[model samples]
Target: MFSIFKTFFWLGWISFGGPAAHIGYFRHTFVDKLGWLDDQEYAQLVALSQFLPGPGSSQVGFAIGYQRQGLLGAILAFIGFTLPSVLIMLCLALLSHKFNQSPLFEGVVHGLKLLAVVVVADATWGMYKSFCKQKLTSGLCLLTAAALLLIPSISTQIILLLFAALIGCKYLASNQSNTHQRFTPSIWPLITFGLLIFALPLMTSGLPLIKLFSDFFQAGSLVFGGGHVVLPLLQNIVGEQISQDAFLTGYAAAQAVPGPMFTFATYIGYQLIPQAPIAGALVATLGVFLPGFLLLLGVLKHWQHLAHVPKVSGALNGVNAAVVGLLLSALYQPVFTSAVLNPSDLVFVLVGFYLLKQLQLPIISIVISFILLGVASNWIV
Candidate 1:
């Protein structure tokens, strides 16, 4: 349990970029380095994360911990992986009075963004090859990516996934039936999740903290396309209560920080409570993360065998292909477009990719290299 916390705590501090990039770091560390999980197991977890809400990468991390050491390990993993950004965002909330970023700092962030591109590209391509092997699945991967590039909405993502599942059921499902293990899923997690979603809104009128938690919980539950997609919904829920500038400040800080972008809730929670800011921050953070964890708990115990079911394996195949597409789209839009502005930025990404892939270097080496490039660019110009 302590080891799980320490490992993820280290990851939280250094896991920059965003959810997809975080996936890359996780694959390299857990799958490749530690041999804690094989590539197929990791991919199944990623697919599960995509199906559920909350912070996609964070849920994956929690599930990974659960796989290793059960529920306590999952909690420790969430706390460890989320603590760094939670602290950073809390500090930013406190320092919002003078929250302007320095040019050198911005340059460092720019270089980190370029590193994000390299990581996302690697993860996306690698998953594509793994999941989209057959003709139908391959077409699903490309078509899903193409569709998302055209219509990049949360609804589109859900619809694409459903469509892929249907197609897989019809065309991709196997004739043979096999059950690897007969594990029964616990239903209390689902029941608790339902009760809260229905109950939280009603309690909101009595307490400001209740309202804050309720709003963030709703945002967490509704999001489908990972952390970035939660921003607009969060702004809508908190817009009247908080200033636009404060909201944007939190948004900026979320982008700049490592680990999960969902920690934007930490900043908002602190801002919402003047008297007990830390308590509010913790509450809000819990609110935002709780739904996904509940859903995960509901599914995870039996998921390994569920995927082995004939019909489910088919649907899982389609979902896996769609997930690859979703990741590939994310890599291009937010990860690539946001990072690579000019030819020089492209050069950095290419070199970083080479170092990561061919040379098989440590991810920390890539991180340090990228940060130095950004700092050097600041001094040179």
Candidate 2:
């Protein structure tokens, strides 16, 4: 358990390139290196995490830890992965102004953004290869991708819920002819939990309410892609009051730190109520991650029963494909738009992608190489 904690801590601090990148790192370290889980189990966990809220990478980390050492392991893993980002975000909140003005910082962030795009692209391909074997699954993948790319207004949650419902209906209709009864568990607990989470913030006041609503909403309601998707939602909510420079700076700083991207909330929260930095950070972090934990518990409790239904599994397969497509769509927006500003930047992106895909290099190495290149470019011209 201690060793797992230490390992998780190290991973939290070093993990970068967003959730997709984090997934690759997790697989490399846990599955490929440690042999903790086989490919199928790991993929299943990934699917499960995506279906739940919060940061997908953090949940994946928790699940991996749970598989290895039960509940205690899960707790330790969550702590280890979360602590570094919390600490760094708090510190950055305090130094927001100075950090934003630094050219080296901007350059590093620019390079990291490019690397993030490549990482997600690589991960999406890898997942597609693994899960898109069946014709139905492949069709779902293509359909979801097209829908996401074409439909700008529709959110991922609605898409997933609709897909899940279709699966449920299909299963019920198919089983209508069979005499064997498959017990459908009451969903009252899930309903109750959802209501409680949504209502909890309303009962609070001032900063507490802000924290509660922000965190709870993030953890429970918002679900687009992964950790990266949280940025815009948070920016819109908090940016109304906070300075744009502060928010953007903190976001860039977030990339430099390790742990879940949700920890960026800690920075925003602390800056919002710096008089009580710890309280602010804690509230923000918990608010963002709480839903994820609760949702995971609910799913784990009922996943076995759900998995037995082929239609349910089929829908999940489709949703998973859609997620990959969603990720692909994002690559062109903020990532490519912001990062590839110059010829040199383009060169760096290609080099980074090559190192990641062809060379199969570690993320840390790619990060370091890009950082050095950024620094060198700045100094040269």
Instruction: Give the Cα lDDT of each candidate.
Output: 0.86, 0.68
Off by over 4 Å in 1: 97-100, 180-184
Consecutive 10-residue window with the lowest summed lDDT within model 1: 97-106
The residue-by-residue lDDT of candidate 2 on 158-273, one tens digit each, is 56546734753453222323333354544654675667566665656665546545554644357445666778778766756778877887887776665687888788778666
Question: With candidate 2 superimposed using the best TM-score fit, by how many Å does residue 311's alpha carbon deviate from the native?
Answer: 3.0
**lDDT tens string, model 1, 23-105?**
98788778878989987788888888877887889999999999999999999999999999998888888888564477777
Q: State the TM-score for model 2.
A: 0.77
**Which pairs clash inside model 1?**
none
After superposition on all C-alphas, the RMSD of every candidate to the true structure, in Å, is: 2.0, 4.7
Assess the local accuracy of residue 116 in candidate 2 as a C-alpha lDDT between 0 and 100: 66
Candidate 2 wrongly placed segments (more than 4 Å)? 152-157, 160-258, 342-346, 353-363
- Looking at candidate 2, the ten consecutive residues that score lowest on lDDT are 171-180
The CA root-mean-square deviation of candidate 1, after full C-alpha superposition on the true structure, stands at 2.0
